[model samples]
Target: MILYTTTPIEMIFPCDQTVFDNYKTISYQGVPLVVEQTDNHYRIVQILSSNPNDFMKEELAPGQLISFI
Candidate 1:
């Protein structure tokens, strides 16, 4: 999964869907998401949004973007 970190999209290990609980919205800009990527890699884009409609679940792909409230 990838997330928009102002500086860069820091990749984490063991990106299993089960680790979603370990992700905290307050600590992160968004939630734990599962995205489909055949390349085994993804890109993170940073965009400011209020009360992001995104919720934590699974992983997210390059196309998936979350918001932070």
Candidate 2:
């Protein structure tokens, strides 16, 4: 997987709850996000963040996908 540090930390998964739980929160001086165990099927660029409130806004939903070129 690639390591993103832009405004919107782009990820290729839907923030896996199980996998995410394994990781401790890392300070970034910016928005923080995690991959959902429910969205491990994705294999592209899936952006996630703490500001958009995907969890609260359903921005990522249970399974969100994105394409990377």
Candidate 3:
């Protein structure tokens, strides 16, 4: 996993979002993404695609929509 900040922050997954099992995978914009659950937070793991900008890693707040085409 890539760490942007030194300290790790705990995140609350969205209740309305799809429940992901460990090692489960999904795709966004044709890019494959793996779902990983840690002791504290869930993660969207993916390999570095050709377009780096296509993979967005950020904290998602409540009521925010994560739309994929």
Candidate 4:
């Protein structure tokens, strides 16, 4: 079988419900981010901002660990 579509593979074959539950959207330092909760910290998943400057910040890069107060 073959599939031809613009949709992402993860969307085509959905992941486990628990996998999706770990992710939550939150605003950190004025920039919106989607993060995954880990033990004692949150892992940056993706930046939801459109500003180019936000992407340039090393601290805001994806996979960075964030500890909320």
By lDDT, who's the top model here? 4
Cα displacement (angstroms), candidate 2, residue 64, comes to 1.4
- Of the two candidates 1 and 2, the one with more favorable TM-score, higher being better, is 2
Q: Score candidate 1 by TM-score against the native.
A: 0.19
Deviation in Å, model 2, residue 28 alpha carbon: 14
Pairing residues by index, what is the TM-score of model 2? 0.23
Write one digit per residue (lDDT tens) for candidate 2, span 1-69. 676555333232536655435432322224343332223333212334546554454434434432222
**Off by more than 4 A, model 1:** 1-30, 43-69
Clashing pairs in 4: none
Instruction: In angstroms, give how far residue 55 of model 3 lies from its true place.
Output: 3.5
lDDT of 1 by residue, 1-69 (tens): 666554323324446655434333222335433332223333223323333554322233235434432
TM-score against truth, every candidate: 0.19, 0.23, 0.31, 0.79
Candidate with more favorable, higher lDDT: 2 or 4: 4
The C-alpha lDDT values of all candidates are 0.37, 0.38, 0.43, 0.85
Question: Order the candidates by lDDT, highest first — what do you get?
Answer: 4, 3, 2, 1
Task: List, residue by residue over 2-48, the lDDT tens digit for candidate 4.
Answer: 89954446535758877778888899999999888988899998888
Give the least accurate 10-residue stretch of model 2, judged by summed lDDT: 36-45
C-alpha lDDT (0 to 100) for residue 53 of candidate 4: 100
RMSD of 4: 3.9
In model 4, what lDDT does residue 47 have?
88
